[model samples]
Target: MTEKQVIYLDFKASKILLDGDFNAKLSDCGLAKLGPTNGNSHVTTSIIGTYGYVAPEYVATGDLYVKSDVYSFGVCCLNY
Candidate 1:
């Protein structure tokens, strides 16, 4: 119905159901889709994420998986 609702549905379908990792947290602003903010027409297409926060496999290849996030988690532990 609303833009936010549509975006949420898309995120659910893409990141949750497809990815099968509902609890997989991202460093971004909790948005699966990268786009412009409120009243801003500049929609960004690139999926730019943090440097060390991203997984190796995901960084090497565009393919993302739960394991990739796990790798990132391990890296985070090492950093701490």
Candidate 2:
């Protein structure tokens, strides 16, 4: 993953792809955004993503950060 990538926003089992080598790649970046590269937060008025994958903090407030992706990734891991 690139440092500039803040979060997958919609991360889930369906969005992950594994190659023949078993290397995982994230896909469906339509909801991805270029956020704080320094690990800060980015606030937006609009929040968009899949349910259950979205962070609770982001759901309460429109603030998005790298941790939001972590939250979604955690959910995906639990599902797997």
Candidate 3:
């Protein structure tokens, strides 16, 4: 499997069901990335999703990496 797939599976397995006090608290707040990605990258597609949940850079460009998983994890954390 790819690195991204491994991360996706890891996150899915780690997720908590979203019907509790912790999710309620996160519902109102958002998280930020610690830094930007390397500028020298390439992407070749357009996809659809909520802006907050989509990694801004990855959506604009196809340049994905392990950090992209970090962005998805943050959004999933909010939902849970």
Highest-scoring model, lDDT: 2
Q: Which regions of candidate 2 fall more than 4 Å away from where they truly are?
A: 1-3, 37-40
Clashing pairs in 3: 43-62
lDDT by residue (1-80, candidate 1, tens digit) is: 53541121012112322236556533324544433446654332334456666655555655444344456455556764
Q: Which lDDT tens digits does candidate 3 get at residues 1-80?
A: 42222223123213335665545222311222222234433333344444565567767664444456577677776765
Q: How close is every model to the real structure, measured as TM-score? A: 0.41, 0.83, 0.38
User: What would the per-residue lDDT of candidate 2 be over residues 1-80, giving only the tens digit for each residue?
Assistant: 75455566888889889999999998888888767655555746487998888999999998887678889878978985
Better of 1 and 3 by lDDT: 3
Predictions: Cα RMSD each: 11.5, 2.9, 10.0
Q: In model 1, what is the error at residue 67, expressed in angstroms?
A: 1.2
Go through the candidates in order and give the clash count of each.
0, 0, 1
Cα error, candidate 3, residue 79 (Å): 1.5
lDDT of each: 0.42, 0.80, 0.45
Q: Which parts of model 3 have CA positions greater than 4 angstroms off? A: 1-52
Q: By TM-score, is 1 or 2 better?
A: 2
Overall local distance difference test of candidate 3: 0.45
User: What does the lDDT read for residue 36 in candidate 3?
Assistant: 28
Highest TM-score scorer: 2
